[model samples]
Target chain A: MSTIIDGLSLGSIYALIALGYTMVYGIAKMLNFAHGDIIMIGAYALFTMMNLTGSPIVAIITAIVVCTLLGIVIEKVAYKPLRGASPLAVLITAIGVSYLLQSVAQIIYGAKARPVTLFSLGTVKFGEVTLSLSALVTLIVCAVIMVGLTLFVKCTKIGRAMVAVSEDKAAAQLMGVNVNNIISITFAIGSCLAAFAAVFYLLQISATSPTLGSMPGIKAFTAAVIGGIGSIPGAMIGGILLGLIEKLCQSVTALSPYTTAIEFGILILILLVKPTGLLGRKRREKV
Target chain B: MSYMLETNNLGISFGGLKAVQDVNLKIEKNCLYGLIGPNGAGKTTLFNMLTGVYKPTTGSFSLDGENLTGLSQETINHKGIARTFQNIRLFNNMSVIRNVLVGLHNQPDFKCNPFVSMIHAKRHYENESNMRNRAKELLRIFDLEEERNNLACNLPYGKQRKLEIARALATNPKLLLLDEPAAGMNPQETAELMDTIRFIRDEFDLTVLLIEHDMSLVSGICDEITVLNFGTVLDHGSTRSVLANPEVIKAYLGD
Candidate 1:
C-alpha cells in the first residue's frame, strides 16, 4: 500500500512533465528536446525566487512567469526559423538548444546542487495504512490538472484551434487560424506545465541542479512513448504505470539497481509490439 | 471599373519552367466563375497563387480594389478568401461539428479569451454555446447534422465533400474557392452537389471561383468561364461562348 502511494506521487510528477512533451509534439509536430531543460530552468528559477522572497506562492508564480518567457523566446529564436525544415535538422537544433540552456545555467549558478526546503502537509493515518499528505496532495493536483486539460481542449475555442492545427495546419490556416500564434500559445502552456511539475518535483527531491531535469525528463519521455507521444491521456496512464513499476522494482532489493534498465526494456518490448504506442492513432494514407 | 477579385499579369515560375504566366483575371462580385483546362495547364497553380499558397514571381492581385498581393495564406483567409483542396483536407480526427467550430474560431462574434475559457466564465459558456449552435446550423445545411459527433474521417465520400464546404462557409468568406469538389462522387451525388453550390451562392450572397474538369457541372452552373492552355488564357467570356470557342475545344479535346 505504501509503495502504491509513493508510486502515484512519483507518477504524478512524470505525468505533468509528459503533458508538455505530448502537447508540443502534437501541435508543432517537432520533438522539443529542450523541453526537459525548461523544467531544469524552472527549478533553478524556483530556487532563486524562494531564496530571495521566501514565499512559496510568490516563488511558484515567478518561476512560472520566467519559464513561460523562456519557452516563448526559445521558440521564436531557435525553432521559428526552422519551421518547415526536415525533422532531423529540427531535432539537431533542439538538442543544441538543450545543451546551450544547460551551459548557460552552469555559468550563472555554478555546477552544484542547491538544496530547497520541501513543502509538506505532514501525514494522515487511516487505521494501519499511513498516507503521506504530500503524496496525497500530488495525486489530487495531478488528477485535477488532467481533468482540467481535457475539458479545456474539448470545450474551448482556442483548444479546438489547437486540435485543428495539430491535425491539418494548412486547413486551419485556410480557416484564418494564425498558425504561428497558436504554436507560441502551445509552447507557453507547455512551459507553464513544466514549471508546475518543477514545484512538485522539488517538493519530493528537495534539490535543484542543472542536470537534475535530465533523468525525469528522459523517464517522462519514455512514459509518453509508452502511452503515445501525441496523446494527452496516454501520458497520464504511462506515467502512473511507469511509476508503479519503478516503485515495485525498488521494493525488491535484487531488482532495485536494474530499474532503469527494466523500464527501457519494457519500452523496447512495447515498441516491438505496438510501434505507435498504446493510444497512438495509426496514420492511414488516403488513396 | 472595379472587380471583386482581379489579377494583373499574375504569374509564377519554378526555376526555368513557367508554371503560369501573363494571366489577367477579372472576377465580378457574387458571380459563379469557372476555370477549366487540361491536366497540368496551371489551373490549380492559379488557385494556389490566388489563395496565397504560392507567391507570384510577377504581377499583382487585389480583392475588392484593395491590393493583397504576396500575402500569407492566413492573411488572405482573414481578408475573406476561403478554399477547399482538390483532395479533401478536413480535420480527420476531430468531430464533424468541431471541424466547423475550428472554422468559426476567428469570427469576432464567437471570440473568447484563453483565460476566460480556462476559468469557464459565464461569457465563455454563452459564447461557446452560440458557436456550437452556429456550427450545428452549418452541419444541418450540409445534411451532416446527424453525424455531428462522428469523426470527419468516418463520413462517406460525398458527405465528406459537403462537410468541407460547410466548414469553409463557417468562416464567412466573401470569396469561396472549390477545387474539383465533385471529383470522386457519383452522378446523383454530383447533381445534388451542383444544386447545393448554386443554393449556397444565392443563399450566402458569395462570389465563387471553381476549377473543374466536369463540363456538365461547369455548363450547368458557371455564369462566366475562363479556359487556360499552356500557362496562358486561351479563351474568356460567357460560359456558352467560351465553351463554343474552337481554340478552347482544341485545348481540351486535343484537336
Candidate 2:
C-alpha cells in the first residue's frame, strides 16, 4: 500500500512535468530543452516570493505567473524565430537556453541550496505511510491541472486548432489557425505546467538551488520520451511507470543503491522495445 | 462577370529553378476544370502557390474576386478553398470520425459553459450529432461508412484515397482542388472515383481544379482542360480540344 502510494505521488509529479514536455513537443514538434530549467526558475520564483512576503499561497501564485511569462518569452525569443529551422538547431538552442537560465539563476540566487521553511501547515497520515499534506496537495493539484488541461485540449476551439496544427501545420494554417500564435500558446501552457510542478516540488523538498532543475528535468524528459514524446496519455503512463520503477528498485533486494540506474534502465528498455513509446503508433507512409 | 478563380502573371521559384513562371488561368464557379501536364510541368507548383504553401515570388491570384495572394492556406481555406494533397496526408492515428470532426474545426465555437467546455460534454457534443450524421453521409457517398470507425492507416489503399477526399469535403469548401486523387487506384476504383467526384461537385456546389496525368481520367470528367509544360501554359480549351492539340500531345506523349 505504501509502495502504491509512493508510486502514485511521485508519478503525479512526474506526470505534470512530463505533460509540459509532451504538450510543447506535440504542437511544435520540438523538444523543449530548457523545460527542466524552467522548473528550476519556478523554484526561484517561489523562493523570492517566500522571502519577500512569507506567504505560501503568494509564493506559489508568483511562481506560476513568473514561470509562465518566462516560458512565453523563451518561446518568443528563442523558439519562435527558429520555427522552420532544423530540429537539431532548435535542440541546440534549447540547450543554450537551459544553461543560460541556470547561470543567470546562480548569479542571483547563488549556488547554495536554501531550505524551505513553509511546511508548518501540513501532515497527513494514510495507512502505514504518513504522507505529507503538502505532498498530497501537490498530487491533487497536478491531477486537477491535468484534468482541466485534458478537457481544454479535447473540447475547446483553440484545442481543436492545436490538434489541427499537430496533425498538419500547413493544412491547419490553411484553415486559419494562426500557427505562430498557437505555437506560442502551447509554449506558455507547457511552461506554466512546469512552473506549477517546480513549485509543488520545492514545497515538498523544502530546498532550492540554481542547478536544481537538472535531475527533475531529466526524469520528466525520460517520462515524456518513454510515454511517447507527442502523446499525452503516453506521458501519464510513462510518468507512472517511471515512478513505479524508482519505488520498485528502492524496495527490491539489493537494488536500493542502484535506484536511479534502474529507473534509467527501464527507460532504455522501453525505448528499445518501442521506439515510439507505449501508446505511440507506428505511423505508416503511403508509398 | 467574374471568373470564379484567376491567376495573373503568377510565378514561384525554388533556388532560382522557377518551377512555375508567369502563369495565368481562370475558372468559372461550379466547373470541373482540369490542369493537365507531364512530370515536372510545374502543375503542382502552381497549385502550391495558389494554396499558399510556396508563396508566389511575383504576381497575384484571386478566388471569387477576392485577392488570394498573401493569404495562408488556413485563411484561404476559411475563405472557402479546401484541397487534398498530390500524395495523401491523413491524420493517420486518429479514427475516421475524429478525422472528419477535425475538418469542421472552424465551425464557430458554440455552447460556452465551463463544465461542458471543460469536459467537452456540451461544447464537445455541440453539433457532434449533426457532424456525425454528415460524416456518415459523406462516408456513405464514398461507400466507406462501414469503415468509419477504423484508423485511417488501417484502411485499404483505395479506401484511404476516398477517406482523404471525404475528409477534405468535410470542410465544405466552395472551391476544391484534387491533386492526383486517383493516382494509386485500380481501374474499377478510378471509375468509382469519377462518379464520386461528379457527385461531390453537384452536391457541394463546388468549383473544382484538378491536376492529373491520366488523360482518360481528366478528359472523362473535366469540362475544360488547361495543359502546362516546362512552367508555361501550352494550351487551354475544351478537354477534347486540349487532348487533340498537337502541343499538348507532344508534351504528354513525346512523339
Chain A of candidate 2 gets a TM-score of 0.95
Give candidate 1's TM-score.
0.98
- The CA lDDT of each predicted structure is 0.91, 0.82
Calculate DockQ per candidate and list them.
0.89, 0.42
Tens digits of lDDT, candidate 1, B1-255:
789889999999999999999888899999999999999999999988988889999999998898889999888988888998899999999999999999999998987888999999999999999999999999988899999999999999889999999999999988999999889988888899899999899989899999999888999999999988889999898999999999888888886
For candidate 1 chain B, which ten residues in a row score worst on lDDT?
A: B246-255
lDDT of 2: 0.82
User: TM-score, each model?
Assistant: 0.98, 0.91
Instruction: State each candidate's clash count.
Output: 0, 6
Off by over 4 Å in 2: A118-121, A126-129, A155-161, A248-254, A283-286, B109-116, B119-124, B127-134
Q: Of the candidates shown, which would achieve the greatest TM-score relative to the real structure? A: 1
Candidate by candidate, in order, the iRMS in Å equals 0.8, 2.5
Give the candidate number with the greatest lDDT.
1
